[model samples]
Target chain A: MTTGQRIDTVFTLFVRLLLAGIFAFAAYMKLRNPAAAQAFAESIQGFKLLDPLQHHHLTVLATFAVPWLEILCAAFLILGFWTRAASFAMLGAMGVFIWAISTVIERGMNLQCGCFGEFSFPCGDTIGMCHLVRNSILAAGCLYLVIRGGGRVSIDRLLISGKPKVERLGATPTPTPTPTPSATPTRPVSSRPASDDTPIALDPVRPTPLSSSPSGVDAAQPPKPRWD
Target chain B: MRFVGRVALILILATVAATVHSLYWPIYRDLPDRQARTQRAPVTDAAAQDGSPTPTGRSELPEHYISVARAYQFWEEGMPFVDARTAAERVVGTIDGAIHLETRNFIDGSATRLLEELDRAFPVIVFCGGGECDASENVAIRLSGWGFNEIYVMHEGYDAWKDAGYPTEAVGGG
Candidate 1:
């Protein structure tokens, strides 16, 4: 493999591993206290997303679901199975997280994020900018995968055999064109056509002018006053 | 993938599960619901300027008795000590000069006619057994209900008084 390709492969692997580790840790912390998880959800002020989950069971369910999704995505990415799909899922989760945090901050609710619970590194009421920065970096990585597709060592690549079929060489002869001006323009229409095949003309015809005869006497004007 | 990471993950999961279990386990287990049943009364500040009787009615004593050196001080001041324990328990130990009012009859005021005969202003130090006893507080509450204003629960109770080598007596059949 070329040096550039090798570097790209290494970078992709590193991103996948980093995402997996982060998600796994986050899931573990949340699974600990479902109440704290519920509180964290309530702290994200917009739309009252947690209102319906005010009950204990629903709250616990939400706590489980979020972390479960994170873990599943992380596992998929780590195993290099459906790498692009997993990365996209992670990206989506991160977007929701960012929105939730921003909403919480905007609404001015003081609460622990429960991201790490009591084991949180620097003690504070809210999850600080560090969490956002970390998630943003992870998000960028996921977006990269979304665009670039999975790199070497991915199961997706292995499962799908050789290189994608290229246009067949020397088969299906290129047609020699007989240029005809048959009223249909060759240029593709930039704007949507009014009808399926008909091309609209640029210029249109104007109406005829009146004749200047003395008998006609310019109906309304009356020969422009004698002073003229 | 490393051995250390695997071990760390296991340890973390175990610790988290244990903590969660501990916090919630009591809810399901038949543990005593102390917070619900037993109310801790606010301790009266010693230096408070008010000579008015500290509002003892608001407090809820956990057991029939409470350890009270203050009630002992009251006893030293020539106040009569009232033993509110059952006749059976009184046989074990009781304070000297303490009148016997068994747990049931004391709070019900079966001895009301006898008590009413005494001077209303005389200080009465009420107590039962150790700090776990609520009988003292119950008697005190009953006395307060019966128009006895100077009722004080000997928080330490008769047991502590006897333990301190201060005084003791056996009353009734015991």
Candidate 2:
């Protein structure tokens, strides 16, 4: 690989690592023991997302589900296993977090963010706009992963490396494209119809294809089935 | 189908893992109303008087939750109330004679001298900013850890106390 390609790989790896590390530590803090879990439950209660009396079952479910899901998805991120799916789950979680934070802010409630257990950084001690911004940024990263998969250094990439491409029934023939982490914009071929592709990158790291293709994405293939 | 299905699968895995862990793990395995049940106050004065932690064998103690009416009754009986809400919340008014010893006070070690002043054997009444607030419960837990024999949390909070027309004084003459 060229110097640029190697750097890109390392950068992709770094993004995955950040996602894994932050989420894992956050999950561990909230799940270290029963007291920690109880504290987290109280934090969830503080948000008053659901009336503790009216939505008792849902409140309880969120208390148990949030941290456990975080830990599980963080493990997936670390292993790069089902990378997009894991990221999609986290992205959904961040949406809930953002909504919860906004609700508390709207209610003018100063709440303790039990986000990283007792550790609150970058957003101060209370849940506020800063916390919302932080969650938004993390959500963006998750969206990127959902769109781009986990990149070349990921298990997602490794799994797809030598697999045969699954093109749509009516797509035109083209050369098999290399498995680059990003959409090879300048180096595209027949996978996507020529007029239907975006030649520019969306993120600093990579751009999501406007449409998703099955595994073993050869940039050269015709436009295949999309998420849409 | 594959992408969405995989995401659903991740969620399923998370839910299953949480169910298993919550059901099986001793910590999470405790009853749901554990906060009310788990009082860590010293079993007896022997260990407390010795200036040593004696958290062992606390099964006999009852839940620390007390209704607002009961709290008022305790106030009439001369039990000192502890305000566990933040300074801003307390500025409006507090249970007359209630001392401000919020959770942050304990965390920052500022509540130490005040804690020293209160008798460990006293059945202290703690309250917070009211509904959905756990500050009082948190302070009660800390007090329990400090060997305070009976620490009751008024979960309905200070608002309920005031709404009931109970005797309340300005926290700082406000």
Candidate 3:
């Protein structure tokens, strides 16, 4: 590999490892006191994005989901598995967290941020500033992955034999084929477009109508076709 | 080899610095104890012996209930009404002339100096969002322990005062 590429690889690896360690520690801290974490969740005024679930149920789910997501993304980042995807997910989560925190601070909420569960860190004015700074750095790191494609040593690179493959599945496949009778003998439809219009128009009569049949003689004759 | 190692080293050092900086702040600071010494009802028995403000011989002190009318009276009389609600709740609405003292620091003794400044005999009413909230009660209890005898818990708090046609104010500034 070129010298610049190798430098980039090393830099990316260091960031991934550092992010992984921080997330792992944060997850552990949150798991320690889920109750306090839940309370902190409720204390925020308008962070009811997960309000589809009942209050405590949402709280419990968040208590588990947030940390686990952090840990999983961190792990993915370190392992370089779907590096860009993982980084994007981590960035999204951090954005939501930053918004939640900023809202709390802007509204002047004095509740503890459950970043480290029951561990009370005084979130004075300085704490908000510090949170923004830290999260912004993490976001920048994630953005680097999104922009530069997961650097070397990533599973994306290793699994694809050095060639990055982009898969595209544009439209859904058609369901089933139904027989469509011709409007006239010469005009036969080959490929029907799958729009709103119906394809089939059944013929009303045959050349030899059913009334001419032997069985038709024994029974009451059927009415002649309107077109005929 | 040297370049890669140097980059790795820098990354590690940066990570360590961030982590250390985040955790290095002092855990908690002890603010001065604000419980008023003179406000405490003089316990005759305790006064006869060691001259601490500790209540003596009184089985139970009266349940200090400061009604909405009384809160209004205090506000009219120029007594500062301290709202013990979280800052967010205060923004929605609060008692006029009430100073915002967050519940977190109310029990932490941060308000000790403020308490010390007030006349021991002067009335200090603590209130929260409403009766459902325990912040006012908690603040009242802490103030009582601080030996403030005239401490009153505005039972219904801001809600009751607002309902009783008393004036309300917007919370901001600090």
lDDT of 2 by residue, B69-149 (tens): 888877887888999877767778888999988655654467889989988776788889877677776677667656676
- What TM-score does chain B get in every candidate? 0.57, 0.66, 0.59
Question: Whole-model Cα lDDT per candidate?
Answer: 0.52, 0.68, 0.54
Off by over 4 Å in 1: A32-48, A52-58, A122-125, A162-228, B1-174
Q: What is the alpha-carbon RMSD of candidate 1 to the true structure?
A: 26.5
Residue pairs in collision within model 2: A190-A221, A190-A222, A191-A220, A191-A221, A191-A222, A191-A223, A192-A222, A192-A223
Arrange candidates, best lDDT first.
2, 3, 1
The per-model DockQ list reads 0.02, 0.29, 0.02
lDDT of 3 at B75: 85
- Give per-residue CA lDDT, model 2, range A26-106, as digits (tens): 888777766566567667777866675567556556666888788888888888888888999999999989988998999
Q: Distance from true position, residue A162, model 3, in Å? A: 6.0
Query: How far in Å is the alpha carbon of A37 misplaced in model 2?
Result: 0.8
Looking at model 1, residue A214 earns an lDDT score of: 32
Better of 1 and 2 by TM-score: 2
TM-score ranking from best candidate downward:
2, 3, 1
Error of 1 at B113 (Å): 52
